[model samples]
Target: MRVHLFSLSFLAVCSTSVANLLGPVYPAPRDLSSKSSRVAAGWKALTGRLHSETSSGSSLLKNLTFSVGLFSIHDSAAESLQFHYTSSEIQNAPNGTRKVDGDSIYRVASLSKLFTVFAAMRELNSEQWERPLTEVIPAFAEYVKSRANADSVYSTPWDQITPSALAAQISGVARDVLPWDGGDLLLQYAIAILAGLNPVPAAVDPATYGLPPVDLNDALSLSPCLANVSEPCTGPLYAGGAANDAPVYLPWTSPAYSNNGFILLGLALANLTGKSLDEIYKQSIFDPLDMHSSYSAVPGASEFPRSVIAGDFTSGFGYDGGISKSSGGIYSTTNDLAKFGTAILNSTLLPPVTTRRWMKPVSHTADLQYSVGRPWEIYRYKHAESGVVTDLYTKLGDAGNYGSFLVLIPDFDAGFSIIGASALATRSNATSLLADLVTESILPALMEQAASEAKKNFVGKYTSDRLNTSLALDVSPSGNPGLSVTSWVSNGTDLMPLLGILLGNENSRLVPTIVSQGTGQVAFRAYTATQEKSGGLFQRNFDVNDWIVVGSGGYATKSLAEFVFEVDVQGKASRVELPACNVTLHR
Candidate 1:
């Protein structure tokens, strides 16, 4: 009913010739082949600064042993320019120490939550996901029935909670069920006690001392898997532990970080699939992605050589997390994690549509930059030049002596992993530092590389063999970004007019899509701008658009705006075929 005048103006402004319209489709991006080299150099400079800073032993990256991996589904060069830092402090014997690389193993802490949620998606149906925790885990259901007061803030509402809630960390449950998740702090306490710095009186029993107990009726914590010190919590153990625990927030009230939630989720998944969480992770993720260096729990002694082990917290590494393996107990190498991240970008495990649904945010957090997805901690990274916000679906983990980060950029079909360990037991600081440094360095490179590739591959004019039908495509870094279809003519009849567009010219963009129509083709759909007429009274976006919805939809069963590119050996565009027009155009 309405159109954006600027759409027509922008399209027409390209030039007097209709061919100008295509210039936006593949505007030549600045040549950044040397940018990656600069990035590599920048890392050296930054790491040199870090090395100088680390002599203090209190630097952010002090005594950090870490690995980083970057991956892109479409381009192999995205992995280049990675850095590894190994601190001599982490090893007792540095005489024969080997450098950490992509293959160095480290505990991945909460990043395991992503794998747990992924396994659930792979095996559970919608109905199963919606099924209440009581139905999913009979043990929890019985606990709910036994305590008529189970729905209060002092206890969890297991009957109303579902697998989805747990996966999203919205189940109103406590953050951790494992006493050992506190091993780092416990180690500190032990050191304090031995140092004669009495934070507590000598009369308090060591077992009864430290953090206050969380039990509801009695002053002591009720369960919290009190029965199992060495094994995964049994059904009754986990249920009783989570049931008596005080609620952090009301169900669906907000998203809180909860390893306990994922542990319960893992248990529910195990009950539903009739398999352990370990099996699910092994079968659904690690095996499919060929993540050979990843392990659900402590790696075998043979694999220990490849593991980055250090600090007093290292003993906790062998502690069996049991069902908690789904929460924060998995171990993986950057090399294998790169495979995992690239698999998600490539849609190698799930269908493209399903993968799309899985990567999205379920709810926003108090912080504008953060959102919660299916166990994903999403960060909104804003580009300085375009102000375009790139959603980074990420997971960060810190436990015992290890810390890690997994980041996926769906918009760019790229991602990276950071794994770090410290004798000082800084769970995530080192990895987080590495992640920030690498993110700053790599995001622009990815953006530039994508633009460069699009420029080389898709920019340029195309015409039918008859030369009567012509299409011009180009890209622009600002104003109109990405690939745009600037001009189009079919047999000397302007297609813009034939489409009934009274606007000056067609303002359309060729937006990239995750799915391809055929083998060896890159998929893209057309997007056009339109705006609904405003009566000059008050206004609402209900009718306004950048020009909303023009050239955006399909005609009949076929789309009126779709295009696929045939690429060359180096992935440069060879031809673009429009299925809607039933015509193929070549460069």
Candidate 2:
């Protein structure tokens, strides 16, 4: 049982156990003594906690089934890990399985939007992004007109809503067209009323609402409002009396998580492509990616399938035969998803340039507390104590009983996915907690691997005895793509007096470009002005073109002052000599 084996708090605790990346020590390999070993040990400790006998009983997370999937690309070496677990009793299980692996299928709610957006992008042009929803669905157009004379509260600018805005989740549509029950019944009436079209009702049980007709054209003929209901379309599905909760802003004015917008976008795709959402995905992506285990609708998936688990509180968890399907109807395994991720990252699915644009930030709030890409999410993970920041392109899915995460970090050339399900009502936060573990553990290790490879040549500590100063070279992949030298008091003893005489206060640190690889000319930008007294008069000193040059065992100062290095047989600098200043720095 993998119950609560990775708790949120425990993940936080395990974060500190990894080797300090900023220090001299390198990240350990995946072997027994490496960082991977620490992760495995952490997992083991948590597993023990999961199975520990408590006054209450066994842990809830240990009582449910779950799975984890990972793939790492560092220095071009690829590695993968996949495992799953289930409770001792089968009936209490969410997916009703004892174990799962990369190939095992599970419902990945909301992640379906990524596929839908991709499918739409392949066929739709830039202009289609802002194309009106009513233009694609004429019935929705009729609904707009019907509400023209009604209160201003229930209407939207039918002409301004676009698939792009909706995909970005900036469209002002309600979060859901209706609550679950209202949504289910609305799909029911939509099928009957849209007479000629085949509509997949929201109801999971076919007996609850028999399969409607298969005429897409006929269904397109239904009015937004039904004649049987004399009142204006209201409640969860329609325009009733104007209320305080009605959307006040138009599309793109703000950000809202609108499933209704996605559903409408799906309809627009069908309308524009003259293909069902199912056919669109099958033809555009699944086939191309070779995701055979993936399904829009699982076969004989009972009201609940062991393969397509739903939350304990969630009502429906099956194919998105209707509107919500485009928003949450995907069922896939980690292996299949990795293939999809590989396609996006490698630009096999779309052109490299276009895919890059797709991942760019599409929506962000003032405080940056909320932000998202076209269909993906942008996340920033900052180490609380060290301030090491990592950027991630990610997507999250939670279908009540099931929760999942798919992440990509281009910086590390690595990505991973986590999918798990639980029938235990107490395990609601399991998925997110596991996501934290992945974030706190896996990512930092991979980043360290990449950094170690990139910095093996020139990163070291250099000390100047005369100046009593120590300089630590940190090579970062950030702006300017170079190294930064930070000055520190040698041996933690304050040496401001020595530093003040040899180097200007402003010259304590240097950020310079790497003019050549293999320890070649490192140039530091030098300041020409000496100092400004209280009079605000700046005294000119060094030449305007002055710059520092670091070379083979020798360096030139801003004033063309030359310093030579004393090197060992390996050509590594052992000491740096500034003849003009009578200073020698030991490395």
Candidate 3:
């Protein structure tokens, strides 16, 4: 919602007025193909260049396995595209003999968090979001009770952490605890062997010989995973390991990444749903979206035909994240990732309001351009043409040789996904560059097309039968951010001046809220441009009101600036309802 009441602007701030537009000048709503072709060509060129350089054995990303694809909620008419490159070395591997394509699967490391949060959103209610982790998981509750009454560096206050906190990376727990590599012990063995000494010592008690001392957090002690070469920690060892984690920051003090936080959340979800995390994801997300190639656990031998083997084919290619799967272990293809992104963007499984609430930032970082959602890394993209900020909900995964990125642009009901694998440090850079290229080359065109489409359908003169009381709206032909109100009259009196305090020199625009108002009706919230005179000397909000008063006037709705437009079959508005003014104007 907009902090400032929606206002209007003139030609000085945006593109030319509607008089020069309204024809074949701008891209039609469904005519988004030319840009897509150019974007596809750009991606193909990048990968093709890398492949050529790799064949010559001179490229920095010589072994990089890369793929990217665009998706849309409206896919039937959408000109979606995919591009990929795989080395012949990989194609000849045992399990990777199959060529890479839309169905080819790679480990989507941290992107699994998106599925975890989606499961939580589907199974848990609003009240459960704030419920403490201690209250949900008995093992974790026991561990917290084992800690002394004081909060210190040795122990985290898990009782104060909630699913919301964990999902938002604000739980204040240690980032990770399992896979505590035992390199020192191996080094000692190496030194003993070099000196012609026996590296193998006589066996001691089985309970005390091979693992760390049996302490509160020695859950890994029951298993050999501390070698960091085994399957992920699960069961008591997983719970105990997480319980022993130290405090990194107090809850909500800062945004800190915590894999164990997600691990704990998986345990809590299992406790609440009476199902394993694997089952939960499969039933709630994967199966429902028809994501045939997606899996929370390792695929069986039959599924190996589609797996992308990056390295250490025996163990690493099909590594099971086990309890930590919710954090960084799942596998998917461009095809499946596209379906998943579409489901979230369209609210296919969840209600529109729930999706809206889920999409918002739970906490913001120090970086102005970045924010955090439940599992979303939101990047604020400002269209240079209209100066409107669009939040691109994204999730990026990086674990060992595997990397993935899922980006959703709600404004255009469009998004894209990228997944790649490489031992080189450049793997992350390659995926990031894919996102930047698409946003730079295609997003501006999409946004401009949206403005033009809205102008053709919604902008016009509307008046009541009472005469002299009318509304006129026009969008900038070049690129206004939203539908600008050129005129508004009520009961023979001009009310734009009355709302000037919130409107601010006529600079607000109506942007879609996606708030459903029955069929053929759409909702829009008002946003007025406000600036500060601090000259970058201070950190502050430029809004005109406090957060406390938000929605208190309309009880969860923007009362002052909400406009409901009754549209027809072709999406042209016939009338607009101004609830704040208790008036309806007809066209």
Candidate 4:
């Protein structure tokens, strides 16, 4: 890896012991005396590793400030830890040192979307979760139609988008439809200003950067709109001619990350609540959580202390953070974020049932390593040494110059939030390194906690002669509450790889973990379904709809397929019915 070491002139005196520099880990009142010592050791080890890794040239983790909060819903006990570090003087900010307590604010880009989504969800009811875009904010849908070519297919499809689908990044909008994901033109200007590079003349004009230049002195007082809109600013990438671009596909055909989706969702939220996005957030989430230091960057109205990007203290236009209204315009501190995350986990912010919906996998990547939730990313994080595969729900934010990550492991009753402010190009990768450390050093500390009973019934060998398939279910005791299954056809062939193309392959094995549709009887449910198809004359050419009978190319209009297992009088599995393949097998 090559380090694009842009010349930076920054100097600061930093000399402190690791223990002194990393402050105390806030523990639950009852366990404070005992838990503090245990948590300190892990914090020290994790920060020490991060500090050492920053010595590398290409590593984006030159400096980091973070907080970790551990809490259990069963017991009201909760704790938090804060750590700050400066790797080397080479990439450090001139005005600010790596020393940050819980209160130091950093610009957290996409992480802002989490707060926006949460606030928006709070204003909606169960039925509104699936409400169409046309109903939520028909005006925005009309705007989308006006920008597209008169005959474009996207104009009509815009009405079909749902708020929940947009939150999950499955709205079928082009990633740059509203182009809130940092415009290239704006980035060019930001890079020049931050890195002291040669100015790209193209970025200085309204036609170039998408929005008019921010008169530095006047930016704080002026409420500038992007184009003709009355909102503070929507980046030029999606403004004017940019909106004319065709969409990737019709709604929900597949998943594609869209900043525009979130932007539109934010507008819909305002329409629903009859309040500005920032106001809706403050009243519902920030104030209730006592996160005093958190604020959404909305033009001149709400500006919090922000770290400098490149060599300059930034505001207005795409300086510190990009000019995104609801997408990535938030500045918050470690302490506040820790509280926010803990509150969500404890159901203090949203009800437990709704919180679970936030983590549920709405859409998954092709490899299945990661799943997209409403505004969260869910995945199994495996610690190498402990070999503990735990489910990690995470939301990552990268504001060009700074990176932020909030991770939660509900099973372990703990989570960590890291905020890094730096000018390194690889700042986005900083969160991954810290997340890995949290999984390795911090999660194991909570090992004494008990596992869910759902695991016991799920681990067994299931086979069906008629269906010609066999399943070996094993207990990943350290993993989330679900059985891990290795599936095979009766011919001893792995059915996983072939299902990849047929089903968009989120994950291979079939694990009927959740119980569904039965009383006084043992039942199970699986997230996906699989069916067989062939390309030969007597067989079909594997129609896209063959495997999963749900979602875009499916036979049904649902997200997950249900599977039910029949158990004998002894509560032992006797046989199973696979819905996707329409087959019955004996255990």
Candidate 5:
């Protein structure tokens, strides 16, 4: 049997308008303040603990060998405060130790899965979730077949995996397993084994099976395999290794790394959206929320930076198609990450209902503290004062060897991200320290401020021509926005029957775009092919106080278009116009 691997270079052709038509731009505050001294004190205390745990000696906060940067934001109706910090001693090898800024970039492994989950959710909201994975990614079928046994009981169609399931790691379609090393030939050997061509014993100790030392070349070469092997073959998890027989696939020479499950997800998302993962992310989330410093690829595209966190290697890794690129490929500053946390907690991007679904704890298995949002973990935090335990929605990422930590804390409307490289494993203490600081000093000060401004600013319908989607904004009883496309509609009358088929109980976010606006005749555009160049514009009929399409002459192009409406302010939307191609705006 011949196996054909899809070339990683195959680029998806996505129309630029997919993002533009989805919605308008949503901006976040650029800077934070320090008006609340109490909050600042708390932050100081927390940061002190973080340093105590991670820094070398009690004095001067030195002995830290890795590069580190930290930032926190507190929001409120009255004022907003922000704090920034960077370690002076630690240095990046190639770049040397430099003063890290809020915008400095670092690899944020596994965290990239969040973008994948969001892309999958977008497809679900568009009612395209049921489309076979083969339709979006033909190569996926091959992986599915090689990974699963014919007799395996968990045999659901690959396309049947919902966005929610993928986010929660419940899809059970296992190919990307944990613990990777550089071993190129082992991948080919593994692939051969999965294809039933290699006659190697079903059970062999990976350490004893003539496996080469774990390294990058070996990881890229390992063929895709199911998480489970044949029955009774359980042993220690088989970290990828290399074979010595083939000189062509050398660990040190090859540019590919295999540990990236998320990169595959990026490919899948790009194929499904007809655009690159980076473009989709910028359009769907980054541009809207104004996360300027965040990006999927490394700087300059020529030389990817080394991971600052220790335990992860520097030379054996390359960004091209490695596991780190997809599973944990994001490089961003602490300031940008903090903004992401605020946007999620404040419902600035996704609708309230959808946000709730993302934060909902779907899995409660004891081994797993919480499950719902794609990359986020549901963990419980004990209130320091009350001794009461409360569920906290969080996500964490470690570049493994790089010694970087990315964390998001939704319940507190606060988050912190740290990047550094230490000679010792204990260097991860920097992450713990930052997390502690946010929980203690930063969040409380920011919560009241976030609550006050959020209550007033985010309660209404927002439409965007760029994305061709609409969002209805509303506040939850807990003061968070209940953003979801599942509850959205076109105006108050048009019900989207397709939503029932596409999402059913699954939650989604409504993307929208503006057509045109005027004092008397405000018009809006929806989803339509003809109006691709000119986002559909609607003008208000002065006499009826209702919105009406500004005629073809009135529009830059007289083409039929589709439009969506957000009703009930749920942050979800339904297609409202197809034939009419226009909508009336009302305050």
Candidate 6:
């Protein structure tokens, strides 16, 4: 079945009314030469500036034994900056001062999703997004068998979901509720109830699913939740007890992780080019870019550091770790990560066209936008002097009690990463501090330098036929110029600094025109139950509505229309109406 996925298009126009209202605005960023020099002087100067305002910030995290590292490499030729950081000291702090350098490996939590993204992209590059799960992952069939057991309540086929959907978290597969909460164990307890091993109250309805009668106090007394909880999937019950119940079953096991998403991409890539993810990364990325420390899997973990990392959830970091690894699992140092970023900016890893496609935002949810190449989060930042809007494209990870974060400003060729222990006390605050430091201080400085260097080459209006958007570009006071795009029909409002890497040419002009020969038609289908209707002329109990267009010009007045459809209980369309339509005529 083919789903009608939405696409956005733009129209070109010079509106006098808009121009008069907004006025002729020049694109200018802040003047950052002095600021950049001050910040680059030393960590003392930068951190001192940060310390003056918020004593409660990283200072509070000082005693927590958290390790914070920052590395920034600026490529003057490419006008980009790359950086990363990691610290095992957060995990084994104080007494066990294992200084985390370039090689220290910590559980990267959801940061592993980066690996998944790369793997998926590799597959896409190799022509493998549409392949079957079983073909890509042999162990996936076993998961299907396990979930399809006679007593199992889940009846959905594993193959019904796609790798991309799983990576994007749109598969509709309900995540397992960890037992830390007061909810009943849905899987194991349900199984026990079905097996008659657990007794139900005589007055209770057998069909009504209720929380397992297992007392939390008793369970806690039996075994603590933190002990031996190697694989998260095994113990669907999040409460205490059975922490060491070897072979726990979290909703997404290792096989399920690979099968559900990550491995599918790996398999797709392998099938497309007859090369494993390891080989592909080595050839296409690592070798070419000299990212020597980067690897698909962590080093010294097993015979094949890569293969060992792909073991069952029991042997790995449980569901969270497994899922992220499949998607974002990549081990690299700050230096190597910087190299990777530079490679991307310089189009060393992939061609410029492919790089732009990778960075193009892919819709995950209404609120969140991601792309094949990067993960992004909407964040609000406050600096001493100014507050600016920053769409921080970053990937975050948390493995067991370890975590890491990597953020990139593609437009500026600037980015930073923070890796540390996953312990609760320091994880959130520390990561936030690191990110703030980068965004408020480090990245701004980097962007200023890049802007200053590339000032001459980056002045012009850039229009997109695909997005039906046009950006008026000019240099900023800081060096990087501001790009302002007036509102189009599709995008509701004017966009400032239309933040995206410029694809195609600076001199290219895009004009939006209507296709006059064709008439556009959109249909709504409804289902109904009525009397036993047989043939093509059968009658239905419910009423059906059909919308038809007799002429082309009648519907061609506007360039964009937002329509709403109403359906009846019988699944038949009651009515279809165009609520609002906006058309912009190109000048």
Best-fitting candidate, scored by lDDT: 3
lDDT of 4 at 547: 26
Model 1 lDDT, residue 165, Cα: 91
Best by TM-score: 1
Model 4, global lDDT: 0.54
Candidate 5 lDDT, 213-293, residue by residue in tens: 554244343432324434221111121211111112211121122223344455556566777666777787678768776
Flag regions of model 3 displaced more than 4 Å. 1-63, 92-94, 126-128, 180-232, 463-471, 477-480, 486-508, 525-528, 531-563, 578-587
Q: Which stretches of candidate 6 lie over 4 Å from their true place?
A: 1-45, 49-60, 63-97, 101-105, 123-126, 138-160, 174-260, 263-288, 295-298, 301-329, 364-390, 422-424, 446-587
lDDT (0 to 1) per candidate: 0.67, 0.54, 0.68, 0.54, 0.42, 0.38
- TM-scores vs. true structure, each candidate: 0.79, 0.61, 0.77, 0.60, 0.52, 0.49
Worst 10 residues of 3 by lDDT: 1-10
Could you tell me the TM-score of candidate 5?
0.52
For residues 190-268, write the lDDT of model 2, one tens digit per residue. 5555565445444533446565443324422322334344454422233221111246467778666766667777777
Candidate 3 — which pairs collide? 7-508, 8-506, 8-508
Candidate 3's residue-wise lDDT over 414-476, tens digit each?
788888876556677655555565566556656665665677778898888766678888884
lDDT of 6 by residue, 1-587 (tens): 00111121111112111000010111112222233443253334555654453345445344222223443233232212222222333324332224444444444555655655554564463324544444445444455655555322333344554455445444333332233211333334434555686464433433455534544245343333333456453212321122112221222321122222343344444555676556767776667777666666555434222111211334342333322234445666555655655565445546666766656444433222222223333232211121222344566664434456666554443455665553445455555555555455564554444444323333344434444544333343331123222322324344332212121112211111111112322221111111223333234212111112111122246211222223232122223333222321222
Question: How would you encode candidate 4's per-residue C-alpha lDDT over 258-316 as one tens digit per residue?
Answer: 77677777776776777877788789888898987777753232332243233345532
- lDDT accuracy of residue 448 in candidate 4: 25
Quality of model 5 by C-alpha lDDT: 0.42
Q: Output the lDDT of residue 449, model 5.
A: 40
Point out the higher-scoring one by TM-score: 2 or 5.
2
Q: For residue 577, give model 6's deviation from the true position in Å.
A: 48
Query: Each model's RMSD to truth, in Å?
Result: 8.1, 11.9, 8.1, 13.5, 17.6, 17.3
For model 1, the stretches where C-alpha displacement exceeds 4 angstroms are 1-59, 76-81, 93-98, 148-151, 178-220, 227-233, 425-427, 484-487, 493-509, 514-517, 523-564, 568-570, 578-583
Ranking by TM-score: 1, 3, 2, 4, 5, 6
